[model samples]
Target: MAALILILLLALILGGAGFAVHILWWIAVIVAVLWLLGFVFRSAGTGGTRGRWYRW
Candidate 1:
């Protein structure tokens, strides 16, 4: 009986870990998309100036 309980507990722990990993994967994808969008907007908005607007 004790061994059965331990086995069940271990399975639950592993299942929870897998769920957490799935959530993290989605979060990472979202962050990557946002970063790409930011890069595009930043470069275009700068208009080739990059470092400064009109050099004072």
Candidate 2:
């Protein structure tokens, strides 16, 4: 009985980790797209000079 419970717990933990990783992948893709858009649409800075959208 204890072994069965342990197996179930392990399976549950692995499943949860998989779900979290999938969500993280989606978030990464979204951030990448936003970064690309920022690069494409960067604003002009002082004295008509083109500058980066991000400070860094």
Best-matching candidate per lDDT: 2
**How well is each residue in 1-56 modelled by candidate 2, as lDDT tens digits?**
99999999999999999999999999999999999999889999999998989977
Worst 10 residues of 1 by lDDT: 47-56
TM-score of each: 0.75, 0.87
> Per-residue lDDT for 2-52 in model 1, tens only?
999999999999999999999999999999998777656654235557442
CA lDDT scores, all candidates in order: 0.78, 0.97
How big is the positional error of residue 46 in model 2, measured in Å on the Cα after superposition? 2.7
Clashing pairs in 1: none
Positional deviation of residue 7's Cα in model 2 after best superposition, in angstroms: 0.6
Model 2 stretches with alpha carbons more than 4 Å out: none
Q: Name the Cα RMSD for model 1.
A: 5.6
TM-score (C-alpha) between model 1 and the true structure: 0.75
